[model samples]
Target: MNEGLKVFLAVADERSFTRAASKLHMTQPAVSQHIRSLELDLGAHLIERNNRMIRLTRAGEIVDRHARQIVQTEEQMRRLVHDLASTIFGALHIGASYSIGEYILPVMLADFSKKHPGVDPHIEIGNTHSIASMVASRTLDVGLVEGSYSPNEVETEVLGADELILVARNGHPLVRDSFVTIAEAEKECWIVREEGSGTREFSDRFLEDHHISPERTMTFSSTQAIKEAVRSGLGISVLSALTLQMELELGVLQQIRLEGLPITRQLFIVTQPSAFQPKVVSAFSDFAKEHFSDLTQTRTPVHRTSIDET
Candidate 1:
């Protein structure tokens, strides 16, 4: 990628000269010079300033699209060269949906880094739809997402299956029984993930299956947020078992397995089809798939000791 184009991308993504400069480790004035030079060479204005806000102009949008491709191509070329030397190096753009990113990915990344220490990871955490789109767009080398997605030019392999269940704050009266019924579960306010989330999709389907129309509901965008809400006694929510390990162990939350409900969804590894799979990408994908069970395993419930008992 051209130097000016690189600077422009940083600016475009950051949407501020000051932030872009900080990201690029360059001065704001120099960053502006690079953008100005690029615009002058192309004979068009690429950005606009209105009320101290930076917005990409029409030409800028076109440039941004093509510039990303240029950068992607350059990265591939670099990977190809490094492959000839049999070295696994360079930054890896890894994307993951919220639940996996929050609860599962750090361990995977840490394990991967132990072998390929040279591989620098850049993570993008978002919902399933967004992660799949990023993988299709080549902005992400690989993505781990739950639920279903069909982005053009991207392929997915099921890494593993995950179980979802209803949960409530520890000792909440609504779940005195180890098993809960949909009728009993439906009366309380339901907390849910955002529209595009895999968890949200499952929650919606679960409702339809049970013929539920909760009287009240709340929405949250992240797994942590939903967990916090449930912990704070805002409402009950359905969530993956993988996310409940620490909370369950600590006695902060307890599972409320619904009768006849053992809800499950496939975990996926999304990647674009390419002739040359970079060593880093292949290594991480294989590692994740092989160890998928480790991430999905549910901790066995044990007796909890209270502060008084301790």
Candidate 2:
């Protein structure tokens, strides 16, 4: 019945058996059979299949709503059982923005994996706004993001601080100076992240505040790409301090001190405001906070000039 309900929901959502089959990795005939079996068991027509698309009947509408609830309840029950048994074995879905996912999360995940070897972790990386949206929709169990999100849709906890610093090639003309003023900074070419990036949002707001509309020569979606471009002297960019560690040490890039720069923002752990959180999700969140807490305490204090919203 659970399987049938799943098939029904997929079909209902897709409005096409073929598409649902593709989504479920099943044959079209198999999907039809599952829907048929479900209708037979219920003794009512659950769906109306037209030549073009499918629509749910009145009974199907009620069934669909109840079916979703049943699936959610089943997941909750499984989580509760695992928690009561003191077992840490389950699949966890996590989403993260590029900054945290690329630079910060690997070590934390490695440590968590070692302690909870039974857990299976799946991570999806996207921009902060997109990742937060996924968490709000419950598509991901939890999300780590570097930007500001709506408080109404999801609950957020400050994970740590990220310092946005301007970086350029070591030999760039700007590097000769101790600090570049807003006027001097505006004369340089810039390589920035694409839209929807938390880092870009903060950088743009900072640039706007300083009234410096620098020429944007290149835009990249990933932090690594932006860093590589900067290294090649394509242009300067503002990036997270955590991301520039290896590049700085390797002399590939150097931070250009701007007179009023180095914006600081809080990284966040976002989750849906639901009453029930799976044990695995809850455990991972707590572990991440505890883990980063120690790392934060040991780090040297960075004097913050201004706080960016993201």
Best by lDDT, which number? 1
lDDT of 1 by residue, 1-310 (tens): 5889899999999999999999999999999999999999999999999999999999999999999899888987898789889898998999999999998899888988998999989999999999999898899999999999874568899999887777889878876645555577778889999999999999899888778888799999988999999999999998887788888778899776565354768999999888789877888899999778665564554332223332
Estimate the lDDT of model 2. 0.84
lDDT of 2 at 127: 98
Question: What is the number of backbone collisions in each predicted candidate, taken in the order shown?
Answer: 0, 0
lDDT of 2 by residue, 101-153 (tens): 99878998999999899888879999999999988877677899988999899
Please give me the total number of clashing residue pairs in predicted model 1.
0
> lDDT per prediction?
0.86, 0.84
RMSD of each: 5.0, 5.0
Candidate 2 Cα errors over 4 Å, as ranges: 5-73, 297-310
lDDT of 1 at 308: 39
User: How good is model 1 by TM-score?
Assistant: 0.89
